[model samples]
Target: MTARETEWISIPMTVDVPYRFAAGRYLTKTLTQLRDNGRIFAVECPRCRRIQLPPRIVCAQCHVRNGRWVELPLEGTLVAFTIMFLPLTDPTTGKPHEPPFVYGSVRLDGCDSVLDHLIHAEPDRGKVWVGMRCRVVLRPPGERVGDLSDIVHFEPLPDQSRPGS
Candidate 1:
């Protein structure tokens, strides 16, 4: 077979798969609180006292069942980040996000874990930083649909200076 005429031909197909996800008690509580009360919730391991997002049944570090439920502050500090330049597919919608979006992990105040999500700041070093202060912006109460999608994005709080600025 010539290089131009390969033995195998490629065919593209679209999938119309439908499915549902079970969040269990731990996640259901978190998602419901966010959707109904406009709040972020986490769980802490009674042993290590490390708080975790998504409120797991057991702590990975301590291997202890988390018992304490805590509400996290809306504000947080950016601990790590990346400026994505590709059309990353969103798991929930099965669609690609617009390119050049700022995404990052923010350690919410009074919580031991960092929640990662889309950052609303410009995808630039000057605008985004490791220690930048950000606030979670959620959809309107009536518009919330009991999922993480209710979070619009993390926007930088006003009057915050970039590191070394």
Candidate 2:
């Protein structure tokens, strides 16, 4: 009856739960546009003028219905990122994204929210950084399937240097 033995132990496990549901009005419109035309769309909050991606029906801040549709440019800035050292399964495709990959949240120009996706860049610290300019790389129109996966990944734009050097 030692105190160390009485301490709680933690265990990690993976649970595979398969499910499907409808992508309501807002998201459906966003995905459809990406799939059909390779265009990105978001909803603007009438009151606050905040543009949201993966458009939602109501504004999370203003509590008003989002009506105005805004087409966002493919280019944006990387707001945050991580170099993953583990092989993580992509829930959307059920495939494992190999380790040591770079992924991050990108705020597309003129939009308030950010999109998270893989970044096609070396995982070296000297290469990727916050505020890196990037562009969405989408699958060809005919190959798209109306899902976020329609976007292959974000590619860093050329001729840009880090803030300090």
Candidate 3:
């Protein structure tokens, strides 16, 4: 074998590299609240008036420490989307999910940022589009987990018409 090929295989896939992460001050308490109850928590930066999802301890825009917690709306509008061809079993239900699942970025109402979530739309190429309205559907009563997946997936809203012509 050439030196290059020999060197490539010599590297170990497993390593003792230290995993370093910025330890937050209050993430544990914040996560506990969410896991115990079905609530979406975010931090509001007093400086920029921007809310950070996942409840960041610091504001990314102004680098200021956020002091207030805000509960955001679960409903949102689909801003972008893509179809995934990968098929796999869902972790919660040990059952296989259908392929061609739609993943989308939804801009939550009353927030400046968008949250990515799974969409439950059919895989027909002609059906999905940007700016489509979608809303969160919570999991069954006994299956709540307080994670984003607690909401099964976003589905297109039904077309409601006016009362009279």
Prediction 1 TM-score vs. true: 0.89
- Backbone clashes in candidate 1 total 0
Q: What is every candidate's alpha-carbon RMSD to the true fold? A: 2.1, 3.7, 5.9
Whole-model Cα lDDT of every candidate shown, in order: 0.92, 0.94, 0.73
Worst 10-residue lDDT window for candidate 3 reads 156-165
Please state the error at residue 106 of candidate 3 in Å: 1.0
lDDT of 1 by residue, 42-126 (tens): 9989998888898999999888789999999999999999999999999778799898999999999989888889999888888
Tens-digit lDDT track of model 2 for 1-165:
899989999999989887888999899999999999999999999999999988999998889999999999999999999999999998677799998999999999999999999999999988999999999999987999988889999999999988887
Order the candidates by lDDT, highest first — what do you get? 2, 1, 3
Which candidate leads in TM-score? 1
Which sections of candidate 1 miss by over 4 Å?
1-6
Which runs in model 2 stand beyond 4 Å of their true positions?
Answer: 1-18
| TM, every model | 0.89, 0.88, 0.70
Note the residue pairs that clash in candidate 3: none
- Which lDDT tens digits does candidate 3 get at residues 1-165? 888777755555854555555426555544555456655667789999987776777788898888888777777788889898888777556687677889899876766778887898877656777877788776765576545667678887778322331
lDDT of 2 at 90: 84
